[model samples]
Target: MALPSADQTGNMAEMEMQWAVKAMHHAETYMQLLKAVGGKNFKLTPIDDELYSDFKRNFPDLNIAVLNDDDFKTDMAKAKWREFINKYENRVTDFNFGSLLRIDCTGDYSEDNTMFVMRTQFYCIEIARNKEGLNDSHHS
Candidate 1:
């Protein structure tokens, strides 16, 4: 398939890349917080326990320390994630928005390891990472 040119894809300013830069910063900030407070003490919210519980309940196969980009991208995974995220849709702000997530909790985001995911899905995985101290390394 031919790649779409900027013209064919419409104004670049109106593209996801524009907002993606901002989203990257947000993700980085969250990572910084994890480094600062130590992942074990970093909470995504007051109900961190419930969020972590639901995450494990729904995704027993997923590895929170090293995420697979396909986990949420594959059709089968999407359905399960959607159902799990729906439980927090009303409470979590912008829970369904696209956000960048790092594949590994022990490293910084990079071109090869970052993937787009729903904000709440990010929350689920990240909450688990923090709880497990997976991203608590000084360099993370």
Candidate 2:
């Protein structure tokens, strides 16, 4: 096997960086859509409602209604999340692949309130978070 030339390696790194930027842009766009629709008060489209139901069914033990739920920190949650990610691996667009997901919609869009999560997982949580009562604390 031959080693990649320095220029080739540099190009690969640059391409990866561009992809990261694009992903961040997409995330920002998603946030904008959420805000435009009224953030936590936004009514989820039917597709999002179905996804939310699936999330509830799959992770029944967790309080999905809680803002920035701490259940994700548990070992069981991690295992279930891995399974959840795998289940939707081929279905979700941009499928996470170690992408940062913003947890708190009202907070600054930074690493502090975000964590690496699968794309579907992001939708599930955000939809749940945007529910009327669940996210009122943040807005209030």
Query: Highest TM-score, which number?
Result: 1
- Each model's TM-score? 0.82, 0.64
lDDT of each residue in 21-82, candidate 1, tens digit only: 77988888986776677767657776789888888887887878788767877899888888
Worst 10-residue stretch by lDDT in candidate 1?
131-140
Query: So what's the TM-score on candidate 1?
Result: 0.82
Supply candidate 1's per-residue lDDT for 56.
Answer: 89
* Distance from true location, Cα of 18 in model 2, Å: 2.4
Q: How well is each residue in 18-40 modelled by candidate 2, as lDDT tens digits?
A: 87887688677766665555555
Tell me, by lDDT, which candidate is best: 1
Instruction: Rate residue 101 of model 1 by lDDT.
Output: 85
Residue 53 miss distance in model 1 (angstroms): 0.4
